[model samples]
Target: MRQYLSADKEKELIETANTLMAKGKGLLAADESTASMLKRFQSIGIENNEENRRLYRQLLLTGSKDLANYISGVIFFHETFYQCDNNGKPFREILKDNGIIPGIKVDKGLVPLAGTNGENTTQGLDNLSERCAQYYRDGARFAKWRMCSSMSSTSYNFICCSNLSERCAQYYRDGARFAKWRCALKIGDGLPSELCIRETSNVLARYASICQQVLRKFSFFSGFRTD
Candidate 1:
């Protein structure tokens, strides 16, 4: 049987999420895969390698404590999650010692959406709920999934949020309590940017809408809300 949350426990989790984003602050995303980092490296004219990645992350991690204060957590890729800074402190220890939580990006690289010409969705849900339980046990306070999707007249209404949101909500219910949804809108090659923006907004809105619906039902049954 699923354990229902007591009111105090529910309030505690909600307060924790708020405390995480307090003082008009947000999260620092150090979680970038090799391919994504390479794209960013191309823009900066730098090589994409372990050292380069470490240096960039260290720059952020060792920034003024003021910046660290605004950043409640640092989401790291698997490689960075295990690396150490020059002082030989593991990245996890460095952040935790500074009061910043360390999180992991658990999604596999993006894959093409079936029946969509070139669009894609994130994978890695194969054992994600179980993996999340392990990450929680391993001291991860949160996990992240960066989802990508696009909309167009040819495929404007061809969107699905059910499975993705279900998995994420389950993660929150299971252990990882905070979740974020990211969508991308690209316009080019005879496609107007405005159309892309509009479509992407619609998709994101719908995604949030569905998530809210799920949470409502979840609260109804669980007798609590993490909103």
Candidate 2:
């Protein structure tokens, strides 16, 4: 079989993950979609406009340099990734300056899966490989795609792993190319069904395997949640 990840590459991935997930520091998930952002702004009585969005993220990225001490990394939505500070400095640079890692949320908002009750799956798979390559070139070293476990089955493992890992290996040859898959499990009446668990676990296992083969890295997970 072809060697997808060399031993050296594997070591690098492990070390990077360990450093990012150190004892106290945490990764911030600011990957909410624009629609989701709007809902949040409404909750707080603020208008959800382009400037407001940029300003909000600007505050997060332009905070005290001491932010690195508590936040190991911050995951930004695509717009936030490219958004600039008042002086035209990109937010990616701000994170780098503060010794914080920059990551991006690449998934388009969730869409309903037809023929299923309240089931949904994430979009953004179209040209995903190309987009990820471009994101890595621009500055993002890691990316995330979240899925609602109850919405889809575990069938895209092979395709996703192969597609993402193949290009990610070349793009982030030396640094990090974390392929983060955020899986959310729900707990409602007769929820978290066995099917959901199996589907999520199976897909995650595939992702993990490819990380071993081609990545040796990804948004290395550190915690789990159920709701």
Maximum-lDDT candidate: 2
lDDT per residue (tens digit) for residues 1-227 in model 2:
66455667657656656655667987788777789899989999999998899999888767666788898767888878888999999988888778777887766766765444565556665555566667767887666666654523433332233233212221131123565665655455554556555655664554344333333344334332111
Go through the candidates in order and give the clash count of each: 0, 3
Model 2 steric clash pairs: 178-218, 179-218, 211-216
TM-score of each: 0.66, 0.73
Candidate 1, residue 219: lDDT: 25
Residue 44 lDDT, candidate 1, scale 0-100? 84
Report the lDDT of model 2 for residue 20: 59
Compose the digit string of candidate 1's lDDT tens values, residues 1-227: 55455566556556656645677666787878888899999998999999988888887787577765678767777788778788887777777787777777777767766544455666676565566566666556656666665545453432343233223322232124455445543434433344444544554444333433322211221222344
What overall lDDT, based on C-alpha atoms, would model 2 receive against the true structure? 0.61
**Which 10 consecutive positions of candidate 1 have the poorest summed lDDT?**
215-224
